[model samples]
Target chain A: MCQLLGMNCATPTDITFSFRGFSQRAGITSDHSDGFGIAFFEDKACRLFVDNQSAVESPIAELVRNYPIKSRNVIAHIRKATQGKITLENSHPFVRELWGRQWIFAHNGDLHDFHPRLSGRFTPVGNTDSELSFCYLLDKLVEKFGYHEPALNDIFTALKEISPQIAEHGTFNFCLSNGQALFSYATTKLHWIVREYPFQHASLIDLDVEVDFSEVTTPEDRVAVITTEPLTHNEVWQAYQAGEMILFQHGRPIKQAMTVVERLQREAKDPSLKRVTKADQY
Target chain B: MCQLLGMNCATPTDITFSFRGFSQRAGITSDHSDGFGIAFFEDKACRLFVDNQSAVESPIAELVRNYPIKSRNVIAHIRKATQGKITLENSHPFVRELWGRQWIFAHNGDLHDFHPRLSGRFTPVGNTDSELSFCYLLDKLVEKFGYHEPALNDIFTALKEISPQIAEHGTFNFCLSNGQALFSYATTKLHWIVREYPFQHASLIDLDVEVDFSEVTTPEDRVAVITTEPLTHNEVWQAYQAGEMILFQHGRPIKQAMTVVERLQREAKDPSLKRVTKADQY
Candidate 1:
């Protein structure tokens, strides 16, 4: 398992507050101390910083915590290394160019025995099931839209249709961004919160740090933060359903979808496990 | 014109000392300061930091100067923005994925009216003639070697054949790396030096900084540095000819190639202007 943090804001903003809390899980508060990486998107261009060192110890991660890099979209990951070895080549989030736009992605859960065919154009530089799935999704999107970049809604619909096939393999919680918007999907655990005009003071759950957002934000500012778990204890975090997908833009979710239980029931390889899931949901 | 700095070393090494003087040229000593970027390679993985702000003022650049990030291959660029606007997208060096490896490049010269036809696989996100030439070169390499990666010597030979075609447009001095070896091509100005055992004192040309290298390095340590201009005045720096290409690996030049002067002489559109170059030699 891994810890993921993402932000999609209406205006350019820094993630020092949230990232500081989230990175504590890398070594201090939690034990996901394999490696970590983050990506910040400024319009269509992006800057990515990755290291095989733990986020708590990496000097580059220290720069991220102290420097106020303004961006509307950002994604960060702290790894526990379930599928890949602890190496720089295996660190997330991964990036590739498609339709003349850079796409970034990070995964939290593990997949068992999942491999998809890839088009020669987009190949994974590192060996990870997450990277393999990312390349597969890009190849499928290119096949769907050809050389032209389609509308955001069209992409959302296509992702909803294609996500279940990958999710059936195992836990498939992930976050993806295309600079314009962020797309998040969850099968096991994920939570999100939106902060707007009437901001209030919040305290970190892992560390003794507090901040009054009202003093730092203007009336026009809005932001959405998503993560593997609630980062702040006071804020109301919304958990996604077992199989749900959401596209976030301008600090809010613009579209949402879910796989119906009947469909999952029909697609499951073991019918007996579906009955167990129904009992557990109660 | 921009300034480029590159390092290919036999072992993992830090460039904090060299970069301190090199970054001083952004605004303090010289005025090539449109923006700046640097990339460090750790095996097949990389860390790229680019800022559209001048290195003298960028806090990220400040962090770079202070942090000792070690790598075997490093490339840095300070831009003057000849063909592209001053923005994050237009900052060099540009990156692309080819044959399942990350390729990084940076340019130091201007190209006028040079746009080569691109095959759809590799596209330039930024509007720079430097990026255009990089994509053109990668496309030609892929066409020449299909899916399999060729031997390094064979690739060097192909670059020797293809570089003159791009250089005819104008100055095409650039450095490229694939995490394995560094390939440098120059048409106007570029210099390189190899530092090994029995090192001596060196003084920076642009800044009042001097360091005795003998105290810092071991007998097994070796490093090759390539730059647009010589950084240290006291060291031996060899300049590349009008059209020379060198491939550096294990901290030394393993192969070299030069384009014939007769070819460049024949390709020049203005025949009567050759006398100006004759005076430069004197």
Candidate 2:
């Protein structure tokens, strides 16, 4: 399985320290060295970089480690080939234009036998199931809400209604951004934490490194980090519940929800659930 | 680049709703379909899955979208090839044994000429810098503290000292876990957020999905999410400062630090910094 790294903060900050430890797993301490990529959000757009090299050995990775480019939102990943071939075209943290803003996405987990028909609005650039689903999702959103962006609450309600149909296929967990807020969801595993004033020292599990946050950030700066696992040795990291969804903005979660297990179980017993797919029109 | 999905809460909650939306990018909406993987932490260990396919097309990803596996800590990623060929050997959320516990890691960004000498304490199973770095980090930690695990704070301090040296070689941003807390850092870009009581509805940028968190979570449940970018449409996401480090435990940022730009500038000015490499070691 691949690993994920993300950050959301009230102020622009770099992730050199945590990234140093996290990158070690790409080839040094663990597997997951297929390829790596990252995106840095600068307002409504992002600076993205990807490499079909391990984080430990890739020349580009070295530049990231040494250079400190600050941003308010970031997403990154290291590949462990699951579906597509190990090529630059199939990197994670995919970027797209939506509502006049650049949206970024990354995913973990797999879906089996999920081939959905799509219109021309959004399409996959690669042959990964993850991208296909992303396109289908955007298509549905535009179809439902049109050009004008809807209120977050309204969109959330629609998402809850549509998610179960997709979940029937397999494990699905992901992170997404539009240079504004972050959205996250999980079916199997995902974790996160928020950092604010009175920051202390943190150490990495993968690397023999530590940093004192209090010395770097201002009292007004707040940050939230979401990853597939805990990145620090001395900090509190929270876990996501099964089938929960969350939204974050201004370094804080603004929305969240849990799947209805009973409903899902009922659907499992019904043939109607099996018919849900991208083929079904919204 | 890869994508990350994470969730953290005061209490165990399901992430199906969010996962459904986020997973779509793996292949359906975005292009991270090289391979997909996820890890769910129950207590100390994790349930992990990886597929060399897009989450949108993979039945496994679909199942993830529907399944409601509950956990407090979780990590997920979608790969885009960079170094190693797309194969199971290169899958992420790489796990290793440390102090009789499993450690997980995922990374984004590339490294340049980051070849460190290994002492055999940890070795690379894949041909990517990510794994090599992981092993090197563990080796360093073990070398510094021996078999017994040191205090998280001490580990953080050590990591701080070691990260810059490694980062000097290339870009380094990553997420790591030792079954205790989630650690994250970035040299370029990363963002994060926290969610607590009174969660509201959230919409996803990649999918037509939304959820009303207030409907499922309790007021006591606090969650922190860190990512490469913000994941929601309405919530505020904070960005990391240039060369910042942080640690997360219990869904909160307990520690953080900023990179010493002055020191880095001095290092850049000194030709000696260029001579620092594995060849110069020992």
Candidate 3:
């Protein structure tokens, strides 16, 4: 399993504050310190950094804590080795090119004998199930939509249909981005929140620090954050229902759907192994 | 640094499939495998699993891949050893008790020289900065709201104000939940999306698997996922702006705000250390 952190906003901003608290978990306050990586979205491009060292000890992590790189969206991760070796290539918040844009991904769970067939549309740079899953998703997308990018709504609908089939094999909870909008889904646990006007003071749960958002942000600016757990003790965090999938644009959720848990459970009891696969039309 | 995976939906769903693909990156695919942990929200309470072994090799992870534990929300993490020693106490998706409810958290990034005075109202169970940050946050919430939980909106407002203060110390991105809604913030990188009707096939970038979501969900179901990267290769993921904060309810963004990066950058240029701390206050 792994930890996830994400940010989405209406305007460009820096994630130094949140990253400060989040990085601590990698080595200091909590033990996620396997490897760490982060991606910052700036318009159509993104700035990405990843290290195979524990975030607490990584020089890059230190730089991130001290430096304030601004962007409209950001994603960060601390690895807890599940399948792959602890190396730079294995570090997450994995990035790829899709539809002429950068697509980033990070995963937090495991799969069982999940080998699937693929075309040349998308390929995994790393050997992780996460990367493989990412490639498979892209391959399916291209196969269905071809070269032209589809409307976000259509994409979201397609994801809703596809996610469960993947989940059927194992725990599949993840966060994804393409410099435009964010997509997240879960089979076990995921949480998120949006922050806007009338901001007040917030304090970190790992460090004895605080901030007043009202002093820095405009009323018009909005931000959305998603993570495996709440970073602050004072904020309101929302939990995703089982079998749920969501799409976010401009720091807000625009679409959503549920996975097929009940059906899977029933099948699990039958012992027939008659499972839902990609062969079944969605 | 660590990786995080999350899911939120209108109905219960199992994360096995996505976790199977994502976990491959832990040790077999990417190498985050210092440790792994996952939490599943079953109604109000959550079922959590943490392993000091690589998720790819852990029997628990294997069970996760084979068994579909249905839940509305899920959070998972893979460690790479940054802060605390590689032990269970250091694993992420950290949980705490607040307002008579369980609060869970996981982070990605690092903090610098971020020791703060605590009031003992919220004490750290671990030495990681992430957990300390969680305790500190709870302490502040207790200071401001006393015993009774405030409205989610009010809490969001308070968090917005305080997050920047904490960010001043270093990066402070995280996700928080209390069995109700999810709250997330980023000072660096984070992304999210929602999935709903009109499902289609999607592929994974890390593996060779694909799924068709349309086969599993209904028109009424909605889901939101937040992560450090996009899990699928083909889908368009939304990115979070720097210094942004967000509140999510029912898988939708209800409040958002962007942090001021320009000011922070200017302050970063200050030569004196004392001035640097003061600049963080601004």
Candidate 4:
């Protein structure tokens, strides 16, 4: 198992506040600490920092906690290796280039016997199931759309169609981003919260730190934070139903779909649900 | 023009000593201070750190100077930004994945009107003549070898075959690596030095720091350093020919070839110079 943290914002923002408490899970609060990695996207480019060391101890993670690298999209992971050796390559979040843009992916759950055919378009340098799955997902994207980049909606559609089939192997919870948007899916556990205007003070669930959002943020700023577990105690965090996928842009969910039980239930009520989903919002 | 630094070692060695002096070129010693980046390879994986901030002022660069990250293959760059904006995306050394391996590259020279046909297999995330040329080179490799990874010698041959054509646009000095070996080519300026058994005291040219290598390294340790300019004043650094390419592995040059002037010079005596070169070693 692993831990994931993702942030999408209407404006560029830093993860120092949330990352402080979340990184504590690596060694202080709980133990998922095999290694840790984080990626911050600035437009089509990304600044990625990864370490095979525990997040609590890695000097790179220390920089992440102190440096206020503001970006509209961010994805982070603290890994407890389930499938690969404890090496730098095995650490998530994994990054790849696609459609002339940098794409970042991180996983939070373990998959069993999940080896898909890789067509060599996208390949994994690390011998981890997480990286393999990420490569498979990207391969599917290229296979569907060819070399030209598809629209965000079309990408969301392709992911929605592919997430369940991969999830069939085992627990498949992940967070993915391409600077413009964040797409998240969960089969077992995941949570999210949106912070906007009129925000109140929020206290960390894992540490004795608190932040008054009103003092630090503008009214125009909106941010969506998704994690494996809720990082704050005061804010209301929404849990994702199993097999649900959410695409976040500009700090809100713009499109969502579920591939398992929820889809079947929605299809029973509306036969026209073949291409649409009830998971439009939380 | 920018500054480039690279190290290839028979054993895992830290670049802190070299980086401490090299980083000074970003602001203190010279004015190539637009931005900077460094990449350290651990097997097939690389830990990359980049900042749009000057290496002398960037906190990330400070960490790199202080942290002793050990690697056999390392590449670093300090940018003057003649080609692209001083953004994180444009900072070199740039990285891309091919044949399940991460390739790291950095250029110290500029190119003019160097846009080549891209077959969409690899693309540049940042708009720099250096990155564009790297993509063009990778596209050539994939075009020649398809999805399969060719042998290092074959890759070296492909690069030798293509280097002069790209150099036709402008200066094309660069250092590239794929963990297993490092490939370096230069049209204008580049230098290298190999230190082994009888290591001596070396003093920095940019900073007042001296290290007695014999005290810090074992006899088994051999290191080859490549840079735009020599970092040490006491060490004997060999300058690359006007158009020369060298492949480094195990801290030594195993293969070398010249593309333009040197090739013609050698060919004046022997027509057999078509497939062979006098640049077999430094």
- Largest TM-score belongs to which candidate? 4
Using lDDT as the yardstick, the better of models 2 and 4 is 4
- For model 4, what is the alpha-carbon lDDT of residue A234? 90
User: What DockQ class does candidate 4 belong to?
Assistant: medium
Per-candidate clashes come to: 0, 235, 256, 0
Please provide TM-scores, in order, for all candidate models, with all chains considered together: 0.92, 0.48, 0.48, 0.94
In model 1, what is the error at residue B57, expressed in angstroms?
1.8
TM-score of chain A of 2: 0.91
Candidate 1 DockQ vs. native: 0.54
Computed on alpha carbons, the lDDT of every model, listed in order, comes to: 0.86, 0.71, 0.74, 0.91
User: Compared with the true structure, what per-residue lDDT tens digits does model 1 show for residues A1-282?
Assistant: 999999999999999999999999999999888999999998887899888899999988998999889899999999999887898878999988776677899998887778777767677788888888888888889889887889999999888867767876777889999899999998889999999999998899988999999999998899999999999989999998877899999999999887545356564867654532331221
The per-model DockQ list reads 0.54, 0.01, 0.01, 0.80
- Model 2 Cα shift for residue B18 (angstroms): 46
Ranking by lDDT: 4, 1, 3, 2
Per-residue lDDT for B1-282 in model 4, tens only?
Answer: 999999999999999989999999998999989999999999999999998999999999999999999999999999998987888889998899999999999997777767688998888999999999988999899989999999999999999988877877778899999999999999889999999999999999999999999999999999999999999989999999888899999999999887676667767788775654333321
Q: What is the C-alpha RMSD of each candidate to the true structure, in Å?
A: 4.1, 26.0, 27.6, 4.0
Candidate 2 whole-model C-alpha lDDT, 0 to 1: 0.71
Cα deviation of B184 in candidate 4 (Å)?
0.4
Q: Of the candidates numbered 1 and 4, which has the greater lDDT value?
A: 4
